[model samples]
Target: MSTEKIKDARRMVHWPGHMETDYIYTLGIAGEKFFTEMKNSGRIFAAKCKRCGFIYLPPRIYCERCFEKLTEWINVGTKGEVFTYTVAYVDVDSSKLKEPTIYAYIKFDGAHGGLIHKLGEVKHEDVQIGMPVEAVFKPLAERKANINDIKYFKPV
Candidate 1:
């Protein structure tokens, strides 16, 4: 390529902008009730498959294994084991945080599925798979029917 052609390419201007929008969303049937329980009572709920006895952490309309409609709800224990974990050095916006964040999959006792959330009150070096942990939920009045209602999982 000629130097003049390269120079012309470098001079091309691009617009920098972002779109602004507002919206409201409703959680689907199963999610609505599951999250509502957390918001109202600071409790976790799971759906049980009547046929196979499979319990899903995030309530589902049907069982994935048996393809059966699930309606039974059960309260899952706050205490669980860390199935997996990761230490995040950077925030979601690509900014570095003062302290690294620990995230993990917490598998509650007697529940088939597990919840993925942040881990707190523990150091990155101490975080380990299979560690006993418990969910720390925000107060009922402060909850808004979302996963954030349970702030984080902390070592027991």
Candidate 2:
């Protein structure tokens, strides 16, 4: 009998609340030159609105303030302070994390707004607004054109 025929000969049962995702995708630009530069150089980069002086982290291709295409990239310092934070008991998949994860909005030195990232090396309860922190990046080989390339923020 064929493999399909063999499986058809057996009975199977489905369980309630047991399902699988039909599709999942890992989508992003294959070649993000700016992000690559930042990761390899260990410097944070942002897009600046030449018209309005508004800066955007994760470097936007266009300026939200002036509605103009951004042509210039600026380097932001690694040193930052926590603007706000929250402690999450759940992991990315919504399952309980081994330990609570501290997430924070980190305002880089001299930047207007902040970037969100995981906060590490400190207890979740101890994370607070105005806490000084800095970016910690992964090895070059492990980097992707994504925010997660900067692994997490650690105490400065």
Candidate 3:
């Protein structure tokens, strides 16, 4: 509008403080099914593109490469191999943890994608790339339909 009004509006807009609001996040179709299987059956799933034979862990509704809607799901199972690993000596808060935690990128047998999760039941010093591992699921009663349902991967 006018120059004076524009200047006043700019001054008004410049004032800022913490913006607070309540919100909920929804997991779309693919995530819902994936977590449901983990919670209900303790199974890991992968989405397969029938046209391209590409499999995606943390399964998606559409193929990333072919862009085709993916409807075929395969049970990738709990077995995997450690693709990579790291040791965390601190917590998320940067506080030193009681013990170091081992984390690994575990690739499922015959699957294209894999999951990054914590490793347990083995010493961090013993962890190796290509180490065979298997997912350990929390008890059925403790499952909350999320990735944490898998407690961790352990050496097989």
Q: Which predicted model would earn the best lDDT?
A: 3
Report the number of clashing residue pairs per model.
0, 0, 0
**Inter-residue clash pairs, candidate 3:** none
lDDT preference between candidates 1 and 2, better one: 1
Off by over 4 Å in 3: 1-23
Ranked candidates, highest lDDT first:
3, 1, 2
Alpha-carbon TM-score of each model against the true structure: 0.84, 0.74, 0.84
What is candidate 1's lDDT per residue for 1-156, written digit by digit as tens? Answer: 534554444475766677999988889999999898888877788999999999998789999999999989999868899998889989889899898888898898889968999999888898889999998998777888899999899999
Which residue runs of candidate 2 sit more than 4 Å off their true CA positions? Answer: 1-31, 92-95
Could you tell me the TM-score of candidate 3?
0.84
- Residue 122, candidate 1: C-alpha displacement in angstroms: 1.3
Tens-digit lDDT string for candidate 3 (1-156): 644545444566476567899987676899889989999999999999999999999799999787999999999999999999999999999999999999899999878969999999999989999999999999999998788999999999
lDDT of 2 by residue, 41-150 (tens): 87787778888988877677787777998878778888899999999998778999888888899987655676899998888877789999998989888887568888
How many Å off is the CA of 135 in candidate 1? Answer: 1.0
Ranking, TM-score, top scorer first: 3, 1, 2
